[model samples]
Target: MKRINEQKGFTLTEILIVLVVAGILLSLILPNVLQAIERGNVTAHQSNLNTINVALFMCYTQERDWTQCADITDLTDGNFLEEVPENPFGGGYDIEDSPDVAAGDINAGKVACSTVEVTVGGDTLPGTCSGA
Candidate 1:
């Protein structure tokens, strides 16, 4: 008498196919996930810029002139800011006295600060700032 055998597991070819499909799906999904994360980073950087701008404006209001805040770190006034906001891309902010642009010109109205040029994963994107 002969006994019948039952199939209880996937074959090697079937397993390979599943793996390839999973890999393809992951490849398609990973870029979008990464892009979303990058966008979030950019948003955070923008928020930081806004915070700094507000603080600078407050400082100007109190002083009646633009403060020579050379960098974000120079903002030590507790009422203004605890410290300088760092560049989300990994560098410090670049503060300068703008005497040309409206609302940013130190001599005209306000002091303007900008982010240092940053590169993300070899791609150069515009940084978060008033002009940028």
Candidate 2:
């Protein structure tokens, strides 16, 4: 049989050292990766808001009434949006249409996320969208 020094496997000390190095590297890198992902999600959320506003605008141009496109299907029927995007946090978009023109909120269609307050990077994004 070969001598113990001739064996071709790592020693316990060497394996422990490797594990320690890997743990240190992950500790340094994991937070940055997670932050980048959160930033991307926030960015996507903002884009979705813009898209909803644009779709509402298109629907209003067709229906001539902001309240007419109260539902996502209403906008989809007019090809305003191909498909509704899923909110990154959770739930779908909330579309609110103002029908009462006399209330001083005429033709104001707003789209917002279910999660009312979305805070990213310690700043709040515009949580609602309007046709105008």
Please provide TM-scores, in order, for all candidate models, with all chains considered together.
0.65, 0.72
Among these predictions, the greatest TM-score belongs to: 2
The C-alpha local distance difference test score for the whole of candidate 2 amounts to 0.70
- Candidate 2 lDDT, 14-98, residue by residue in tens: 9999999999999999999999999998899889878977998798798877567778788777899999876786767767433
Model 2: per-residue Cα lDDT at residue 68: 78
Residue 17 displacement (Å), model 1 = 0.9
What is the Cα-based lDDT of residue 96 in candidate 1? Answer: 60
Model 1 residue 72 lDDT score: 55
Can you list the residue pairs that collide in candidate 1? 72-84, 98-105
* Top candidate by lDDT: 2
List the candidate 2 regions with Cα displacement exceeding 4 Å.
1-5, 98-132
Residue 15 lDDT in candidate 1: 100
